[model samples]
Target: MSAGRAQAFWLRNLTAKIAAIPMILTSLVIFIGCSIWTVVYSFTSSRSLPVTDFVGFRQYERLFGAHRWSLAVENIAIYGVLTLVFALTVGFILAALLDQKIRFESIFRTIFLYPYAMSFIVTGVVWQWMFNPGLGIQHFVRQLGFENFTFDLISNRNTVIYAIAIAGIWQITGFAMVLMLAGLRAVDDQIWKASRVDGIPAWKTYVMIIIPMMRGVFVTSLVIIAAGIVKLYDLVVAMTNGGPGFASDVPAMYVYNWLFERANLGHAMAASTMMLLTVLIIMVPWFYMEYGRKNKN
Candidate 1:
C-alpha cells in the first residue's frame, strides 16, 4: 500500500477511527500506563506512599524473603495445578457425555454452565458455608447417625488450599465445559461419520482425532484458567480470607495485604510486578503461537 492509498483508507474510515480513539486512549492510560507506573514504583523504597527514592531490587528481595509470601506462592502453585487438571478433565468429560445426544441435553448444558454465570464471590461464600463443619455436609452426614464423621477441610491449614481448589474447580469447570462443547460442536460432522465407518471406537476416535483437532480450544481454556489462578483474590477473601494462618494466601492477597494493610507500596508493587510477569510468561508464548506463526506462514 502506498502512502496515498493508506491516507485515503484512513479518510474512508475516519469516523470509525475517531470513535475508536476514546477506547484506545482508555486502554493506553488505564492498562498500559498504570502497568508501567506499577512496575516503576516496584523498584522504589516507598512506604505508605509513592516516592522517588530508587532502592534497586531491595523491595523484591524482601518480598521473596517473606514467609507469608512464600507460603502464598506455594498455595497458589498447588491450587493452580489442581484446578487446571480437574477443571479441564471433568469439563471435557461432561462435554463428551452431553455430546452423546442425550435427552434434555440443553438442560444438562445449562446445569453445567450455570455455575460459570455466578460471580466468584457468590461461589466462594456458598462453598464456604458448605465447608462449615457445624452447619454443612459434616453436620448433615453426622445427623444421619454416622456421629463420628469429620469434614472440616476449610478449618485445617494442611488442606485449606485443597478446599479452595475444590471451590474454584466447581465454579470454573462449567466454563471449561461450555468451551469444550463449543469446540466439539464445531468438529466436522463427516469426521465422526468417517470414524464410525472405520470401525473405530468412540473413545479412541476422540483421543486420536477429535481432541487433537481442538488444540486451540484446549490451549485457550488452559491459558484463561492459568491467568485466573494468578489473579486469585476475591474468592480467597470470600471463602477463607487466607485463614488457617495464611495457609491459603495467594500472591494477589499477598499484594493486597502489603498495599492496604501493611502500607508498603514498594513491596506490594513488587509482588504485583511478579504476578504481571507470570501472566506475561503465560500469554506471550500463546500470542506467538496464535499470531506469530500465522504471520510467518
Candidate 2:
C-alpha cells in the first residue's frame, strides 16, 4: 500500500475510535493493569498491606495445602459440571418446546425467562429458604401427608454442593433458554420444511440438523455459563454462606475470605491468579476457534 493509503487506513473511523478511547483505556488500566498487579503480589508475603517481600511459591503452596481451599476446589468442580450439564439440557429442552407454535407462547416465554431477571443473590436467598428443612420443602411435604419426608440437602456437607447447583441452575437456565431460543428462531424455515418433506422426525431433525447448525449459539452459551461457574461467589454467600462446615465453599469465596476476612492478600492473590489461569485455559482455545481462526481465514 502507498503511504497515502496507509495514512488513510490509520485515519479511518477516527471519530469512532476517539469515542472508544475512554473505554479502551479503562480496560487496560482496570482489567489488564489490575491483573498484572495481583499476579505480582501473589509472589510476595503481603498481608493487609501490599508489600514487596517476595516469598516465591509459599503462598501458592499454602493455598493448595489448605483444607478449606481444597474443599472449595472440589465443591466448585462438582457445581460447575452439574450446572453446565443441567443448564444446557433444561434450557435447550425449554427452548425447543417454546419453538413449537403453542398457545400463549409469549406467556410461556415470559414465565421461563423471568427468573433470570432477578439477581443471583435474590435467587439464592429465596432458594435458601425453600431448602430449609424446618420451613421449606420438608415442612410442606410433611404438612401434606408425608410427615417422614426429609429434604435437608442444604444443611448436609456431602449434599450442600447439589443445593448450590440447584439455585445456580434455576437462576441461569432461563438465560440459556433465551439464547437457545434465539438460535432456534434464527434457523431457516425452509430447513424445517425440507425435513418434513423428507419424512424426517422432528426430534431427529433437531438432533441431526438444527443442533448441528446452532454451533455458534451452543458455544456462546457454554462460554457464558463457564464464566459464571468460575466467578461463583455471591450466590454461595447469600445461600449457604459456605455453611454446614464450609461444604458449599467455592474458589471465589475462598479468595474473598483470604483477602478480607483473614487479611492474607498474597494468599488471595494466588488463588485469584489460579482462577484467572483456569478461565484462560477454557477461553483461549475458544477465542482462537471462534474469532482468531475467522480472522486468519
Candidate 3:
C-alpha cells in the first residue's frame, strides 16, 4: 500500500486509536520498561537498593545455593504439575457432562463458576478454614462418631503442598470448564449427526473425533494454566504463608521475601529474572507455533 492509503486507513480509526493510547503507553512503560529494568539490575551487587556494582551472576549463584530457594523450587514444581493435571482433567470432564443438555444447565454453570468469581485471597482463606483440623472436615467427620479420623494435611509439612494444590485446583477448574464448554459448543452439529448415523459410540466419538478438532481451545487453556502455575503467589500467601518451616514456599514468595524481608535487592532481582526467563521459555515456542506458523501459511 502507498503511504497515502496507509495514512487514510489509519485516520479512519483515529478515534479508536486515540482511545487506546493510555493502555498502549501503560503496557510499554510499566510492563516492558520495568521488565528491562529488572533484568538489568539482576546482574548488580546491590543490597538494599538498586546499584550499578556489577556482580556477573554472583547473586544467582547464591540464590541457587540457598536451601530455602531450592525447597521453594521443588514445592512449586510439585504444585504446578499436580494442579495442571487435575484442573485440566476435571474441568474437561465437567464440561463434557454439561454439554449433554442436562437439566438446569445455567444454574449448574453458575454454581461451578461461583468460586472462580471470588478472588484467590478469598478462596485461600475459605480453604484454609476448611482444611483446619479443629474446625473443618476432620471436625465434622469426628462429630459423625469417626473420632479417630484424621484430615490435617495442612499441618503436615510433607502434605502441605498437596493441600495448596487442592485449593488452587478448586478455584480455577471452573474457569477451565467454561473454556472447554465453549469449545465443545462450537463443534459442528452435523458432525454429531454423522456420528449417530454411523452408530459410533458417544465416548469413542468424543475421544477419537471431537477432541482432535478442539486443538486451539486446548492449547489456549494449556498456556493460561501453565502461566498461572509459574507465577503462583497469592494463594500460597493466604493459605499457608510459606509456613510449616517453608515447606510450601514458591518462587514468587521467595522473591518477595528476599526483596523486602531480607533487603537483598540484587538477589531478589536475580530470582525474579529467572522467573521471567522461565515464562519466556514456555511462551516463546507457543507464540512461534501459533502465530508464526499462521503468518507463514
Each model's lDDT comes to 0.94, 0.93, 0.92
Q: Give the alpha carbon lDDT tens digit for every residue of 123-155 in model 2.
A: 899999999899899999999999889889999
Q: TM-score per candidate, in order? A: 0.93, 0.93, 0.92
Q: Residue 146, candidate 1: how far off, in angstroms?
A: 2.6
Worst 10 residues of 1 by lDDT: 108-117
User: After superposing candidate 3, which stretches have Cα over 4 Å from the reference?
Assistant: 1-21
Candidate 2: segments with Cα more than 4 A from true spot: 1-19
Model 2: ten consecutive residues of lowest lDDT: 288-297
Best by TM-score: 1
Model 1 spans > 4 angstroms off: 1-14
Clashes of 1: 0
Locate the minimum summed-lDDT window of 10 residues in model 3.
80-89
lDDT of 3 by residue, 1-297 (tens): 699998999899899999999999889998999999999999999989889999898989998999999999899889988888888889999999999989999999999989889988998999999999998999999999999999999999999999999999998899899999999999999999999999999999999999999888888898999998988999989999998989889999999998999998899999999899989988998998899879998
Residue pairs with colliding backbones in model 3 are none
